[model samples]
Target chain A: MAMLFSDPFESLFNLQKALDAFHASGWLEPGPSAGGTYPPLNVFRKDDDAVVIIELPGVKKTDVDIQAKGSTIRISGTRTIEFPQKAGIHRRERIAGRFDRAITIPFEVNVEEVKAEYRDGILALFLPRAEQDKPRSIKLP
Target chain B: MVAPQELAVQPKKELTPKEEKTVPARYYVPNTDIHETDEALTLVMEMPGVEKKNIDVKLENDVLRIEGRIDFSKYEGLDPVYAEYNVGHFSRTFALSNKIDQDRIQADLQDGILTLTLPKAKQALPRQIPIN
Candidate 1:
């Protein structure tokens, strides 16, 4: 099946970057409130199936919890990073702690058939459209 | 005990390579944290979706370079519908001091995070002096 949907937010980021380049300083920098959502996601759809990918470095599978209901999916987890007691922090930029995010799709999700895979700190969920939500063709006499 | 709160994912920053590259590919610098102890200096980098075999660590002229390649074949037949971040190879470099013993440096990769330990030279370490 050919891929039908593409990330709608991709254009927004491109536009923001272009504006930033023009002004050298982003007057519209959404700051930490907007655009900076935890556990960044990428969604791809092929026919009636959609795959959601999340990047979570140094996270354990046991820490994350995923749930799907109707047209929404929720992911919640904690990220912990530990160092020796005597170690001194030189420069810290990476983030840690807990994160919870919810995403809603256009069609009802087949929660029972959804498949999840975690590898190399990346979690991907394969969601199929619900059977009842699929379009049906009617025959005329 | 305090409860943990939600974290914001920082926007990915792009790093432009200074020198001309043989391959015209975009490279994003991975997020890193540096920690130092009496014995060694540790560097932790976030490089998701990259296998251990695809990473390269190099040292030349007291400069340490790190690079990780991502396999694009994973997205061959897929079309993106929503993307919050761009996928690309990771690249970054650090200038090391003589106090670091490059020969004793160690590297480890786990769960898409790369850790590098650079041990201090024996002579550079502080020593306890006895009373005369």
Candidate 2:
């Protein structure tokens, strides 16, 4: 089971610092200037596979694009909002626009075995480790 | 109208032992958008990983509350190497005013996005009266 930590604000602060570093290093292209920040993601390793989950609410499955090469994966999508012409805007907090994010895994992955599933606005990816990258245990003499 | 002195006051309900002992769980506030039209108000919220069965919405005493629980127990026993987004509960509250018709409010959830429509009360709607 996933455990909820007591200090989310601190975690978010650290994430912001990491994002800033990524931007300064040119590792990730700055997100769209008009909309909000990039979507939050979780990456974890399950044995010999790397699992990635991204939150993309209000985005259609058809609009999302995923690509993987070597040890890196890229995700790009757009979210659109449509309201009636006569509707009056009250409060607008959710941002809608195009966003792109690329993440690098710690180990080389098998591109052919990559699997992706989108459900409930979450995009989950399973990337299997390359044959040569899997951990091997040696017997002691 | 009955006089205030003649009305009987109801006793306040007591909290059960289980309710008193229960600790409140921490909740993450989901991103939301609010729009208003001539006839109604619309609210859209983002709550990923929440399904229909795990979502709860309650309206009482002019306060609207929404809660969503995401269960990740299915992945138990799997090793975790890196984690960024934490899986947990999502919750938010909204106070409704007299201008809204509480009984006619409607809500729908799709693709992890929740949309709520609060219709304006008849008396609160704008009207154009013709000059006699």
Candidate 3:
């Protein structure tokens, strides 16, 4: 899951998105706070489970740690980006940071059955709905 | 097929002579086609090699900015054996008009495509009137 950006226009686009990220997290930065890299996340709710995904390019499976509670989940990871040694670097855009994101879910969830998987820089989390949290189908008498 | 122990990730390589320049060149400035209707304005952006996580859409200083980053480097102590596409981040800004309702803008990213739906300001939206 290696991620390196070499485009010239990337800075301009990141500036726009960073503004929105600041509004959501109350801080413009994510990571270890010491050169932390904050990747974006997408959250959605299904009928039986809640799915949360975080983009973590170049991060290895062993590099991430996740914790889940009744209605919240925490993800922590790191991306150490390296560059070519003999390339004679003129511009650098790779980010190195520790990332910790804590999300409070909208509904009660089953924490014991939560699972996470990472592939090709995408982390997928599946948290099943708690027994009482799931909607029931009833037949009228 | 490669085994688990011998998994060989792509290696980082030195840039070609073309890549050794000051600022990378782009074929064109990524732009959006904005079409306004009675209710919403549809914006389609030209963004390739961008993912949902790398993309950002926001309004600041009366400008609509679109941002994205791409990660494609493979490994250390190795050099790329082949190459095709170049990876880079993208940024583009558009001037927001009085006709737009900034607060209600909705964006969706799918398969590297970013579609933003911005509903018009009520006063700026078109209305129908009947002449009796």
Candidate 4:
């Protein structure tokens, strides 16, 4: 029985590796052509809701656009920097440009009830799971 | 132009001292942007999850040190489902040259961004001389 499952598991691992490689190439759709890279983000599940936290320093709230559909959420924003003319820049490590990121939740989400908040350069999103996607305890007669 | 330090590890001495404190297992070197104007040098650093009260900026022995402590306790019992960023403290140091006006250095923290302004010394400021 172990041998029977090994082949499929190996194939699944290979598929995951391929997906990782694709993402690392920085060619994901709606790419960073605007000079911005993907912002760091975190996803946590609590009870029946999925919470997503994103770091977007130097980006104003007005510049951010978020859209959610079914189980996918898309976030896009722009970061701009302005320096005085004739001023010499000694060092620059922060990236300033437009960025787009799309994340797929593991479970279906209730689109209408999703809530979002931006504070302290961080964006937090609360997505409630769909009725059918949430786990329920069944009553046994 | 000096390249801004990106995710550079702290020297051993700096790391050893912090280990005795809150004892964070890791440190994330925050991305920073440094700009020099005729008046001063400005540095902007990105450090999310670090509140204004938790940031420490010190200048001593001609070195400017910045450390931001992350409050991981905020997530106390929440299980992490996915994470693309690590939860840890942020630290970096810059050696100040004699041209910097150490006494006038100013720092501000807002919305997770730290801005530091290091003014230039009077002697270092450029001035136009009248032609004789």
Among these predicted structures, which one has the highest TM-score?
Answer: 1
lDDT of 2 by residue, A1-141 (tens): 233334543433333333233332433233333232366665655767877777787888998999898877878777776777888777776666677676777678899999999988888899999999888999999
Instruction: Give the winner by DockQ: 1 or 4.
Output: 1
The 10-residue segment of model 2 chain A with minimum total lDDT is: A27-36
CAPRI docking class of candidate 4: incorrect
Candidate 1 residues lying further than 4 Å off, grouped into runs, are A1-36, A136-141
Question: Which sections of candidate 4 miss by over 4 Å?
Answer: A1-37, B1-22
In Å, residue A62's CA in model 4 sits off its true spot by 0.8
Q: What is the TM-score of each candidate against the true structure?
A: 0.83, 0.75, 0.40, 0.75
Candidate 2 clashes between residue pairs 3 or more apart in a chain or in different chains: none
Q: Candidate 1: which pairs clash? A: A6-B80, A6-B81, A7-B81, A7-B82
Looking at candidate 4 chain A, the ten consecutive residues that score lowest on lDDT are A1-10
Backbone collision count in every prediction? 4, 0, 12, 0
Encode model 1's per-residue lDDT on A1-141: one tens digit a residue.
232225433433332343233332221122222322678777766676888888898888898988888777878889988887999998798888898777777778899998899988899999999999988989897
Which residue pairs come into collision in candidate 4? none
Most accurate candidate by lDDT: 1
TM-score of model number 4: 0.75
RMSD of 3: 21.7
Supply candidate 2's per-residue lDDT for B80.
44
Please, what are the lDDT tens digits per residue for candidate 2 over residues B32-51?
Answer: 78888889988898887788
Model 1 residue B75 CA deviation (Å) reads 0.8
Q: What is candidate 3's lDDT per residue for A1-141, written digit by digit as tens?
A: 122245434533332233223334421122232322244554434445666655555566787889888777777776554443332233233344567666666668788889897664567688788899877899899
- Please report, as a residue range, the 10-residue window in candidate 3 chain A with the lowest summed lDDT: A27-36
